[model samples]
Target: MAYPRKPLFAPNGAVATSQPLAAAAGLAVLRRGGNAVDAALATAVALTVLQPPSNDIGGDLFAIVWDGERLHGLTAAGRSPAALTREMVLAATGRRAAEPVAALGGAQARGPAMPARGWLPVTVPGAPAGWHDLHDRFGSLPFADLFTDAIGYAEHGHPVSTGTAIGWARAVAGHAGLVGAEFAEFERVFTVGGRAPRPGERWRNPDAARTLRRIAETGADDFYRGRIAEALDAHAARTGGLISGDDLARHTSTWVDPVSARYRGHEVWELPPPGQGIAALLALNILDGWDPAGADPVERLHRQVEAVKLGFADAHAHVADPERAPVPTAALLDPAYAAARRALLTERAGDPVAGDPERGGTVYLCTADAGGMMVSLIQSTYLAFGSHVVLPGHGFALQNRGTGFRLDPDHPNVVGPAKRPFHTIIPGFLTRDGAPVGPFGVMGGHMQPQGHVQLLAGMLDAGLDPQAALDAPRWYWHAGRTLLVEPELAARPGLVAGLRARGHEVAVAAEPSVFGYGQALWRGAAGWVGGSESRIDGAAVGY
Candidate 1:
């Protein structure tokens, strides 16, 4: 069944998001003589307020941009505190920790976790610094202007979209103990009776508004080196947390050339190694070698699945911070190596097995303004509510992304001082003949690469529109050996068996699968075609 919503096409500028208000906010910025970078920054700031459960100012941000002539990537992902070490955490808890989510689950099972107290889970928040850096480098409008829409939404209130409401409700229920006085205060301002506010229900966040106003009045320094930093450090000090004023002062976003590879004449660009954007690139590279033009539908699906499995094997084995990771980038993406890896996919699927390679939220936006500038940006708190740490005066939560690091010293992504962990959040862009073609992203921890593969196959190989490609059925193989196929795709019974025959140990998803919340802006002959996933309650707007 097709979703009933009119598609938006604009010749000059457009924005697509999981919420219509956000799209409108970006479009408004574009109309106000802002470039794509400005529009995206506005929309991103707005999302932090409107989609609080999935994102916050205390999270991490990653982006890819088309700045006229070349593509650029911003890796503003947060890092573990310099004081944080595996030994320290193990010593504090008197046990070796699993993933952060695992620790959260354990805490839930027994009682409230330390993170609920708003101190222990704090990390060096990168979003604020990242936003400032982007504006300083490429934005056309005043940095203060970007916070206006976000501040208004937080203070005066905005309708809660269906997708956001559902996600919020789930987060609240899952991490009930994390709900402290600060969260309770937010409930009083935003929710009705400690429950999710329905779609069209008005919700406000006065605390967040106050926080934004502070940043606007004092500038980014207030966040990194001034009062805000002091407040964050104080909270961590009182709790068992590790962040320091030095960490805040030292935090800065990195600007680097976008990493990319050619796939079927289209160039796919993503952030480099420290992030897992290469997983998507590697998958596309493997698929590019396949004959999508002549292969049967089932055969195409089989090859795509095989390619992803192989790509992920490499990702798990080697991808990490380039400074620390042992595997060379050239070796991993080498054509000869890819051919050798592709050989592992037999005509028949392998046995039902978990891919033991690497370990693993979120808003995605794509904006293009009248200046011909484009940006694909993503930000998140890792899991919903992050470490569930809501700083008191900062009006933001912090990310638990440090949980992705391993305690095993031998692991490529093992936690260390000044090292970026293997990140799941990645933004993507596509170009053809050296010109930007589209800005898109698939957001879900491990499912990101899989989502990218499907999106590329649909748009480039099958010639489907952006929305149709996103609307198409999707699947994901969890690290736990479960093959969570979406209900729509499950309807095709033999397909599962076909994959099973090839040796995949598959099972139907207990809920909707972790495919991705995709958003994109495709450059077509007509103009810009903006598309947002129907699975998410969002829209694409253009002018």
Candidate 2:
């Protein structure tokens, strides 16, 4: 189904998000004389309450901000518990940390990485700090003022939108049988009457309201060093969790430099390491080598898919916590190296190996204020309902970001104490000629970078508008030689067959959610132009 173009244009401010209410929350902040950072912070906080299945107060955050003069990057991701170690995890799970499993013929390799859910994978959350720090740096409104809408929604309840309802049901189904104590709090807080809420159903979480209020009033200190930390400590003690008060106190959101790749005269910017954003940059680097302007439709997609494969292969091999491991970000994005990597691409789908130069959730929301400040932000709990270990009486779950750590001792991403993991959620921005274009991002685990490439290609390469860029069908590169495309993209004339002829495996996606939900804001002559996801219950509001 082709979505019709109905872009929102506003003279003063614009906000876009995966949930409509969240978008409205940001817009309201802007109307209240807040800057772009404040509006984005409001939207992000509102998403925690409105889209619990995707994000929460327990999640991590990353953002790229254009604060009139230049761009700024924020990495609010948390680290592994200070007490956690590979040996401890192995012992807890009945595996030998120093020995290899019998199935693999290695003498000294560990077993698989940590499980997807439970206390072992829970990391100290950085979102509260993220909110406070972003505001401290670039925000105009009072920090407490930003929480008004989120607290109201949590206390008084709001109708569940279709997208949130669908994700909520799926998360409930996924965790149906794990009746352990670690998951009990999640079940209690999220499920009402032993089931997920239906669309348009009013759902309330007064506990979350109380928590947000405290965080706001206390400037988020309680979450890291005070009452909320005490509660988290007690809960961890009762549930055999590893996070402690010290771990919570040690967590901080960092202000880092943003990285960029030049694509067709425009520079696409993303947050630096500890994120897979570099993958999007690498893929764009490869795509830049080709004149996609006059390329065949099928051929254009083929190159795009192949480029992403190469990008992911290298990113998986080398993109880790740079503070813990060496990541060759500069060498990888070098034009000469990108050209060398591009040399591997052919008419057929080929599995490209990682080059030596190497390396490089998850709400995505963007806001633009009349002051010319633009912000691109993304926050997530890693997976749905995160570790399934909700803070008792808090009505929020902890993120399972520890699962991103590889178990192998020789790997760059090996699990260890006080180290950040390879993160999936990233925020993106675009600019040309040293001036800001606007903020943009796509929210879905691995589909994020892929969506970035496709979005930019549609706009910069194909001359499509923001709405058309988002409304276009998407394709996800699943694995080696395999591609999962939307039904609409598959239905394109000769597209699937053409891809198959090039030694690619093409399957129409079983669900549309895998393609991701995206948001974008572009500066127009009259004001800011915004586009939101058509596949999800999202909106791009302007005022």
Candidate 3:
């Protein structure tokens, strides 16, 4: 079946998003002589104020940029404070590391009472550092100009899109009691009639507006080391949290080369080791040996499923911080290794394996300007509202990315002072010969790799347009056991049973199962073509 909306194919500049307003804001920036980096920065900042439930300024950011010829990955993820040790947390609570505390959704949960609050979900905030770093490197306009649209939205308010409203309603109802007073204030600004504001409803965030003004005036230092940092530190101390002013001041974003592997003559690039982008690359590498071009429908689907499993298995075992794990990057991407991995895929399915959740709630944006600069950017609060701890006076929630760290001392991703955790959120890009093909991202946690496979298949093998590739039916291996197929896919009567006959535990999800929010832009003979996911309330706009 075809998607409801037509595919967007632009020949010049284009922007796609989960919200039209956000896309328009970014497009406006591009039109005003800002490059892709500036447009992406503007969209990210606006999302923080407008889509509070899914993302925020207090979250982490990751990106892959097409710097003309090669791709570069930036790990804007933050780490625990230097003073934060597993031993300290254990000592404070007098509990063993592996012992299960209250379930995240259960009564007596130790973290913040509300899911949107900053206290329950605080981690090092990374977006500010990331924005500054990207601007310093590739921006054309003044740094302060990037905040104009975001600041205006935060102060004067923007209409809450349908997607934002749904997410906010869920977060407010699920986490109201868990959050502290600051978040309560946030709720007041966002909620209408004691619930999330519906689509087209104007929503303002005055506190965030003020915070943006401060950052524009004083630079990111106001956030990393100045008054905002002081407020964040004081709030943490009063709440018995571990973050300190020093952690805020010391936080920095790292720049590295993106990892890429060839598939069907096109090169797919993604963020390296710590992020799961490599997992997606690994999966594509394994599938490279399979003749997806001529395979029957069932045969093609089986190959893709097997590739996902093998890639995820390797991810669970090897993907972690390169600094700590000595990740065998060369070995894993080796053609021989891919051939060996592909050998494990039979004509049938098998038992599922559970994958870790890196960052769950996040937003992805891609932009390109007339200057030929392009950016694939992602930002997240880790989980909804992050640590759910709203900093008292800053109006920013913190990230809960610390959850990705393991308590096991032997694990490569073990929690330690100032160590980056295994990251799940990653941005992707593609190239042919030496030119940029598209900037893309898949947002759902473990579903990201699987989403990449499908998107690649649609674009490269099936010849579908970018929006069609995104709106196509998708499947996910949730918790590694159940195959939660999208309703559209599940409509095929014998498909689920066929997988079950092959030893797969198949289950039908009530909704669309795993929804992947993605956007893409490809260079056509004339110019650039872009498509935003129709499953979301986003739009693709260009000149």
Candidate 4:
């Protein structure tokens, strides 16, 4: 199993992404003397152009980068607008107290707890500012150079990949036309003739190109405090939304230290609070107590599922913006907490109670340069097309990330001025003995951290190579007892029966794509090995 099934090996540099164009764009940058950071930035921007349904200029961004000596984590998630509040949403929706996520299906004689796709949940976008912060820190190429390929694709056109086309169609059906008249712009721009583009269809966005060109020329400041911000403010004002010019001007991405846990001999790292990355660390810490190699596949899945629940319970209670509600990243990831939670796991799924912690559509890419620099970056528009309130004339949508904030004022992640919500997307990294091992990540709404735990276990415990680790069938646990198993995995004779016997209410995923799409790069003696999830239109490329 350790043998790579479809590993792509490279020597000087390597880049992997969920889209071939994005991967190639990054690799081309590296080939042209760009470092890993430059390549990662290129790929991230290209992803926004190539996969609009999953990631776009509208979303948040997070990254874990290893620069030979140290690992740096970035929090690029946007905060609640100064003018926005939970009460504002309640008022706009005509409710005393807005509904919660649990009452998502049209509350009993009540409007939905929160607006899933509208300006009510629009937060200030941070990806543009995030790109500038990253480039300012580690880029070797001109900031504008990083977006060249992405701009070309946006202005001209590119053939849609099978997966992206499928996802785009779903977004059209799910996010567009469902809101109100304001979302009409989304239907106009995202769809072709009022329908999602079919696979192989050529799509272009000159508006997005113009926006990128502006950012390229003036840096991301144009997005945060300049023209784009003005447009956002005007749109918000016209649409009765919350974002203000002040909100955009005050936005800045935070640079933080990476939080990590040791699994076996290697260290697994993730971005700290406000993101669900801790879920991966917590699960790994809990799994560290047992001998994974000795456990059967069912046992491994069961253990990870249980540990994730505990992590979520704590994260929901504790994880929030460091400025608004500082999370004790060190204390939360302490060995003692994980060990105590580990002790609660038994033979079957347990209704694990939280010790009272705390905490999308997404694109994850990784790049490794010959100079020993590696970056694991992720970005997302939250729910497909994000808010569905496309900014007319600007060619980009705004993120519904604010929907993540709890309606409860007592909650740590409750909506507040300039507070980052409980973010779902996280980029992951690995190292051994203080040396960089590589960069890795999975992207799929809440399935991100879940995928991280599964992928890390597959490689660390089962001795699977990067590709085999990614290729392994996936299982996701949710809402307590329900376990969604991939059909490929459900077909495994005893797997379903075994899970059901252990108290899991098993259901095979009708569309396995939601499990997640991942990209990974492993650095070792030979050079570099990269893996892209088999379920996407992705590739691992290098020069």
Candidate 5:
């Protein structure tokens, strides 16, 4: 069922994103003499308008930027509202106490848990600040110009894509029973005639356009300290929400050095703690001990899944905000630690346990410019439609990132005031011998790093082209020893049987989105080559 597609080549620039329009928006910026950072910021803003179910202006953002000479990492994830506390959250959920994932053997939390969508799970959105900071550091074009396409689409309307339509319906269905006043604005802003828009239907949001204009004009100050913050505070006071103007004003995105692990002959890079980018690095570290270059398909997959399980186990155990608690980043990425973890991966899939390292959603996009600058960026609202708490006048939803917090009091990521919770969205980049290769990323909740591991193996080890690597059948280690594979992968001549023989609870998934969608850009001798995700409506446009 593979489609005939080749990587697009461009001498000057390239942009890839989940939506065709978003990619085009970035390309337009490149054509306007904007650098890769400008193109990336343009695309990121447009996605908030074009793909509302996946991301919005009211979300978290992380990025790895190659500004020609070196790499820069930005983590714009927001902290919990100062008004919120662990005691209040526990009381709200009616849970006397909570159990850690270690106690549950990495099973999805059962019993009382944080609400998936509500004012309770909402946190300070850091994307607006992220956009501002990235531009201040790397942009070559006027900041206001980046919002032109996004604002135009928001005001004039654009046809919804198939994948977005499906997600829109699912989100509406998921929140159908929420009739609270806090949820009313969401229904009004996102729906037409009380329902999600169908594919190709024109969707407009004048309010969102206005808000984007304010951010563009004020350089995002409006979002954190001006009118937008006042409006959000007023809404929170009226509703039973926790966020306040102080929380918004105090939010600041951090710039950190990118963490990396050498894989094959290249170095894979991601942002550090509090975000799960380390999980991909951890998995890669363990995987580096053995060369799966020409191994059997089953054996390669088994090792990949096993490494991922161990990575997630440790990530879930230790990854928390370093500002709040200690995160042994160096210890976790140590070569010796990886060797010790690799030894545990036997012929059989064993229950993964924490080895004292650490842990760590959303949309992913990559843009490359003729100047050799590349940007890998990811942003998200946590879940489909986020907390489903759209701002009344602004017409955007806030992220439910607080849900990533553990309810266990002893956990490093426990819910607390002004502390960032665990983040799922991560952007990745590749380099060899200190030279830039390209920027790449996958977008899904926990499937992000898993996608990173699988995608890299295909491109680097098997020598598949970027498109082929993305098109290849995928697998996800859901929880425990259970493994979810696409129907195509299951049909791969005894692939399922082989995995099951290794004590894996193999389940063939019906939906392809469960494996996530990704985009990649590779720097070749000829030019910049790019690949776009085929599982959804997307494009890789260059010139």
Candidate 6:
């Protein structure tokens, strides 16, 4: 029988990434005898150039790698600048630290809540640190070798992908009106002729090329403790921003033990706290007892969304910097806790409050080499252009990841000095009976875990192929029963009716608010089989 969507198969190697150019970059590295780690870095770096709207060198990085032996996790997310304190933020924005973050222009009526659009929302960038850390450990290629594709694309040019074009234009439209110089840097880098780039239009960033070269030659030191740091400091000082050379110099990516949970016979692995990976595991854990395959299509999807709602609520309460997080990682992922949380899901859609749990885009790439090495990596510039503050001379955009923090001083993720805020982007991996299943991930904002759960259930429970599982109609449970379901699901005969009967406000739309793009690659009996996102301009390549 043929599958709903065909999977790309390869024996020597395979790559699945959001951008075709970046996937080619990885395939090139693999052809040169580079391992998965090298190819992954190359792909990641290339993306900072090709998919400039979604990610950049300025964002943080996270990855889960299987080096043919043990799974290794890397946390490259940066900390809040030491100079940035609750008092300082309150003084700058004139809002109490304890107040809930106001909407952009809500009557709670203050400046945009919690630095939603500027330097104050940017943490020290962690991408360079992460690249260096990955290379220093598992990479086979020289550091500079990874930059060739990225530099070429940035200096010469690259054609915008469909997904990237949509995102780029949306970002430009969102920030069209800003009075200050800090915001001008963002407009300068992303907009051409005061507009988002048309799809297939050629774009170049020589400034980013120069910056990448400096990072390449200096071994990433320039980004943290050297000239790169100086430029960042000068920008921050001039703009009255809190970042400094010390913040950049003090940053370090940490090596961490990955967390996992068993769903049926398969083990799903994700990065630990400070990331929302646990949320995916939490949802899966709750659904482990039920046989999703036995349920009707609507029933299966409803259970997944319900479980995710519970997981997100707990995450809101418990997940944060491990240092300040109220809920311990061990307690959060305990099967017993997941079981209890699972009980909250019922026949109707109702917002479930967290008892007291603990808790958590941009691009997701999975590359596998012949040697059995697989890397699941994700990086992103939070909130479009990220802080909407680009350095004048440097080519990279600063991530507004600091916007992930809470303004409520009592919250676990409350704004504080050097604290890593709650993060949304997560990388996922799967395995069965001690053997490698392969690397897989879905990229979007809060939609990541929801996508992961749906894809896994489609394959593991519903017996669908990789491509079929990914291409299957998806539902985005934004909050409670408010759902944005793909039009495909609407046409599933009675899928939408069943869901609406269960109290879900299902809005059937083709785009339904960035439902997320996914990529999956696993060790098949034949070789490596993989697939890319259908919603974007990309493909799965094998060789």
Highest-TM-score candidate: 5
Best by lDDT: 5
Worst 10 residues of 1 by lDDT: 103-112
lDDT of 2: 0.87
Per-candidate TM equals 0.91, 0.96, 0.92, 0.94, 0.96, 0.94
- Candidates' C-alpha lDDT: 0.75, 0.87, 0.75, 0.83, 0.88, 0.83
Candidate 3 segments whose C-alpha is farther than 4 A from its true place: 1-3, 89-121, 177-194, 356-359, 510-513
Model 6, span 1-543: residue lDDT tens: 424558898998988998999999999999999999999999999999998777898998999999999899999999998877777778787876555653211122222336677777789888898999999999998989999999998899988877789878878887876667777677667778889888899998999999999998888998998888999999989987789999898898989989998987999999988888888888888999677656788787788888988777767666788866655778878888987878878988766543221111388899999999999999988777677788988877888888777665656777889989888889999989878998989888788888899889878887777777788878787654688888777888898889889998889768733678899998998899898877786678879
Tens digits of per-residue lDDT for model 1, 1-543: 555444568998999887778888898999899999889988988999888877888888999988888888898976667887766655555564544322111112111122223433445777887888888889888889988889999889888888888878877676655544334434453347877778779987788898887776665778889888898788777655688888888887888778777799989998887777777777787777777677766677778777776666666556666766665677767778777766666786632222332212688899997667899999987777677666764567777777556555555766667667667788899999898898998887778888888998888888888888888888786543346677777678578777667666676663442667889898767679888878887778888
TM-score-better candidate, 3 vs 4: 4
Q: On a 0 to 100 scale, what is the lDDT of residue 485 in model 2?
A: 90
Predicted candidate 5 versus true structure: per-residue lDDT over 237-352, tens digit per residue: 99889999999999999999999999998999999989988899989999999987578988999999989888888787788899899988889999999999899899998876
Candidate 5 residue runs with Cα over 4 Å from true position: 97-112, 353-361
lDDT score, residue 140, model 2? Answer: 92
The stretch of ten residues in a row with the least summed lDDT in candidate 2 is: 101-110
> Which parts of model 2 have CA positions greater than 4 angstroms off?
1-3, 100-111, 352-361
Query: What residue pairs are clashing in model 1?
Result: 18-538, 348-502, 349-502, 349-503, 350-502, 350-503, 352-505
Total backbone clashes of candidate 2, pairs 3 or more residues apart or in separate chains: 0
Candidate 2 at 271: error in angstroms?
0.8
Candidate 2 lDDT over 45-111, as tens digits, reads 9999999988999999999989899999999999999999989888978888776632111122234
* Model 4 bad stretches (over 4 Å): 1-5, 97-113, 179-181, 353-359
Lowest summed lDDT window (length 10), candidate 5: 352-361
What TM-score, to 2 decimals, does candidate 3 have?
Answer: 0.92
With candidate 4 superimposed using the best TM-score fit, by how many Å does residue 187's alpha carbon deviate from the native?
Answer: 1.8
